[model samples]
Target: MPLTDLRQYIEGLRSLGEIQEIDVPVSLDLELGAITRRCYENGAPAPLFKAFSDHPSGFRILGAPAGTSRQPGLYLSRVALSLGLPPNSSGLEIAEAMAASLDLPPVPPVVVDDAPCFENTTTGDDVDLTRLPVPLLHHGDGGRYLNTWGCIVARTPDGSWTNWSIARMMLVDSRRMSGIVAAEQHVGMVAQAWADIGKPMPFALALGVEPAIPFVCGMPLPAHVNESDRLGAFLGRAIETVRCRSVDLEAPASAEILIEGYLHLDEKVAEGPMGEFAGYVPVEPSMRRPVYRVTAMSHRNNAILPVVVAGEPVEENHTAWGIPTSAQILHDLRASGIPVTASWIPLEAALHWLVVTVPRDWRRRTGIEDSAALCQRIGKEVFTTKAGAVIPKVIVLNDDVDPTNTRELVWAFATRCHPLMGHATFEHIPAAPLLAYLRTSEKVASATGKVVYNCLPPDEWGEALPIRASFRHGYPPEIVDRVKRRWHEYGFH
Candidate 1:
């Protein structure tokens, strides 16, 4: 069964011995972020910090909430626990499970009169955010960040659409925050709607929700779809949500901390220089972004704030966002009549690379004559989708190439792609401004280009097919079977 709450998810990790409880005194300034970063990079147990004497006892910190594990058979156990799957589930299995949820009827969230998030409340002048253990995520960051692994809940003025997204938030003062709400992002779109009506946009920053919540919230689903509804459908149950004390919105009942606020329509503050998911802290100057004014804050007893120190790959940003993004692409490609057998974003690529696979007999099945033609169709379908906003590059390969295997991806990318004629670019699409390659103009216009590197075999272009020189395909079944049977004798492990 899927874990329903953050604490339950933590217990699940504990069962697998994937969680580390640290009672040692720790500093929120940079020590916490460093330890969390190492966990993500090294696959150490997720840290649960409880000895920050400077902060309120009602506050704790959990880091690397969904990071990939170094364990042999349970590399993605944390992610699987979040999605309600077995510990040994593969990356492709998780992605396909999420994609299957797209076919089910959405189950809207269930509202409760009260939840754990309502246990304690601070309103108006009492809501001092500085009292919390907000950590400095990176050395040169603009300020201490407080929302690295949280949800930003916003709805349209007409109340027809509610978008739950993940974005960074930097603390400005006790009651104010500066965060990114790029115009192309869903939160920014809704904020613009509120600006048109001459009012501040109401938002709720929900932290420490159930493990599954952030996965759907961070997904780039269609603008018409509500993540809360899709999340309920994914688990085949309605998620419990509660009304915010000061905002006209709902937050997850499982939240460890909740902050209700209004985003100023026109006001701006310099934010950023924090390390991002792609592994690099962009060298650009601090960009001015919209400001958030906190109205109320609430939390349960001994609240635990979950955080993602997103810098390198294999972190929450890569696993959580990358898995859902692959699912969305797989759904869209199949819907568009493309024969995409599998799709994946290798962890080390940091969500920049989308690896798509087609069956060997795809040419005969779809009657697609050439590699270039198929590449065009794939690009047209993928680059136009909402999830494609952050995908800077896509790689097309045969089903035999196992999209989930980064080594195979690297092998195919290096050997199969023709330098002169293997790739195509799609320009003038919505740009994800965080990418370092984007120019100032593209960022301002919210338009950029995407590329597709055709790694499909040249056999599609009328040449005789070349044989794959791998042990699985190159050798006969009898020899492979014999080798496999004697693998222990060969001392391979």
Candidate 2:
């Protein structure tokens, strides 16, 4: 059966020995975030905080549900299961499934009168933001955040297309939350359109919704494609949604917490200095961000609000958004007739660097100048478009290596790539503001331009050339199988 809620997914993780419960009281002020970040950096199990000083009865917090693991491929395995695929599904399998589902017709959402999320409602004077144990995630964080892992739902002014996305929001007061909504993201674009028409943007922030919802939210779906429908397509079933009490938007029926709000065009407030995915805090004070007015709040009894501490590697930024976005880019490239064999968004790069491997046959057929130039073209195509803005660097590799393996990638760079010979550069291509180099470097021409570091040497392009053999592929298959079959007999544990 498909996993429908966060609790079920947590149970699965527990069964795999990938989760742990902490009975000790953990403060929301920096302590919880610090512990979670340490756990992620060390490839430790997920943490469940059973006690919070201010949280309502039955409410709890879960951090890093899908994170880096010491066990090989476990990170991507958890992500695959979150998307309703088998836990052991390969990256290629996940990419193909996502691409294939694009052509499948969407299953319309089912409307329901009531849901578990609406068991309690707080609005008007009764609502108090401080009552929830929202974490001050980082040491330098400006305030408590309640929407790090939550999904926001917004529709265009015409109400034709609804966009779902993940954006960080901090609780500013009892009735207000603030956060940056970049003009490039779908949510920001839709909000811009609404603001242009002098209308308040209706929105619903759903916490602990179905796992598939947030994954679909992070995807770069085509304009006019409803993300709710995409969620349905991904899960191979209809998503049940209920209308928000104070907003026109619909949120997941299984959501643990829902905040109905309206975003006015005129209101803006400072909203950052929080720990980011790039592993650094901005030097400047927080910039003015859009202000949201909460009209109603509803949640299930003992609702668990999932927190995503965005910092260096192994956080949700890498496992949840980075890996899947890379897979979708590969899918998009292949659909557009560009042959892509595999793709990886490395954890160390903080999801900004994307490395792709394509079949050598396709390279030969295209007669590309070199892998670097090919990478530049691919980067421009992706970054100049809607999907590419979030990516800054692209590395192209031959299919002989696996992009996901950092060791194999490093080896390819060390032996095959010539620094000056393999480099390719592009100008005036759009890029996200989160890149540290772009933000701090005086040499950067503009946010949109980028440079590609091609690690392969030019001499290795010939099809007839024999390259150095590696242990994985160079071993004789029969011998390898014989060793595997006799491992127990040989007394190997």
Candidate 3:
């Protein structure tokens, strides 16, 4: 079977030298967040702080659970390991493989009578969230966040749809939390359905689930499709769940900690103004968002709390979320008959750029006459989809330029794309409000223009294409083979 839970996944990381456990006492203020941020910047091991400065005993925090690796041929090592893939899987392979799995039949969750999380349970007046030491993930954050890396489970009142999503929640008090529930988000939609009938939405906040759980939860799956089923489909087995102590929902049996609660749609609180994943320190003001009231808390002994410290590039937002998101896009594109050879959501782009590579014979395969027309079709296929809402720009290139290779992609984009005529833009589409460049109208309406840049030849140049001037492809095969074979003999290394 696949690595089905957090402990199993952590051991896999240990074998790869992708994780580190800190014995020294760490603070929940800014110290821990700073450490995780530096890990992302330097590609250091995921820091598992074993001791806390304030709430030292009975709790542990794991930061950068799926951060990118700097080691050679292991950039996405943690992500791959978490999803039960080999440590050396490439970005394209990860995305394309997951995309193909979307075609499989969904495997619904199987409810189990007991789980590790059920070892200890507290209900009614005993539920105190502050005892867990929610981290102030950044200096600019309004309050310590409790839901940065967890999954929130909400089901439609009619029991037809259930959604699992990651939304930031700040500790409001002993039993209350403030979080975002945007109307466009699935959780928000589910809450609204309950609100129409005048009842608070019951929910369960699941933290430290199996590595693959959070990644699947973060995917922009179709509105009615269950995230648990998608996860089960990917794993080729049924996922196990245990009933929540207070709520009528069932949470993943893989969760290390689970908080049962009700989402008060009428209850709003001042939230936000935090450093986010756009690679920028926040300067914005706080806004009112929904509140979550905790009713029950359940956990195992010395339960681990996983955190993202979401900011900059290559964090969970880019790794767990971005990788799976790109997989859905690749699946959508291929399902639409677009001959995409590879698709990649680059880590350094901070979730702003989606790089897609099409076969060199795209013109012949797509049966399009010109680059502009091809770009328009690509735009129509991408921007019109649900997963494309967060994407501001897409870069389309011939498969000769690998989308996962930043150097080659940058070179091809800079050299081949015509400044004015090589792109097509669509307006009045939904966009994430966090985009730094959105105009006030766009931000308010959550609508903006999305562009697709063409990095291939403008017309069917065919045999007239210029040769690539590079070490890998510029020389004849015989000469290249000889050079590679004698590279060490020449003392170049």
Scored by TM-score, the top model is: 3
Q: What is the C-alpha lDDT profile of model 2 across 110-140, one tens digit per residue?
A: 9889999889999877777666678888888
Over 4 Å off in model 1, which ranges?
Answer: 53-56, 459-465, 490-493
Alpha-carbon TM-score of each model against the true structure? 0.96, 0.93, 0.98
Ranking of all predicted structures according to TM-score, beginning with the best and ending with the worst: 3, 1, 2
lDDT of 3: 0.87
Q: Clashes in model 2: which pairs?
A: 58-302, 382-388, 383-388, 417-455, 429-448, 430-448
Better of 1 and 2 by TM-score: 1
Q: Point out the higher-scoring one by TM-score: 2 or 3.
A: 3
Mind giving the per-residue lDDT tens digits that candidate 1 earns over 1-493? Answer: 6677788889999999899999987888788889999998889989999877455565889999999898899899999888888889999999999998998999999989998877888999999998778988888887889998898899999999988999999999999998888877788899999999999999999999999989998788988699999998899899988998898998888888999999995898888879998788878889888899999998888888998988878898888899999999998888888888998988888888899898877777778888888888888888887888888889998887888888877888899898877577888977577766778898778788888898877854553456779998899999999999999999987
What is candidate 3's lDDT per residue for 1-493, written digit by digit as tens?
Answer: 5888888888888889988999999888999999999998899999998898877588888889999888998888998888888899988888877898899999999999989998888898998887786888888889889888888999999999989999888898989998778899899999999999999999999999988888898898988999999889998888899888898999888998899989998988898877777876567788888889999998889899998888778798998878888999999988888888877788788788998887767767878777888888888988877788889999988888877778988899899888888698898988888877887788889999899998877674862457899988799999999999999999999
Q: Which stretches of candidate 2 lie over 4 Å from their true place?
A: 54-58, 71-73, 367-373, 440-446, 456-461, 483-493
Q: Which 10-residue window in model 3 sums to the lowest lDDT?
A: 456-465
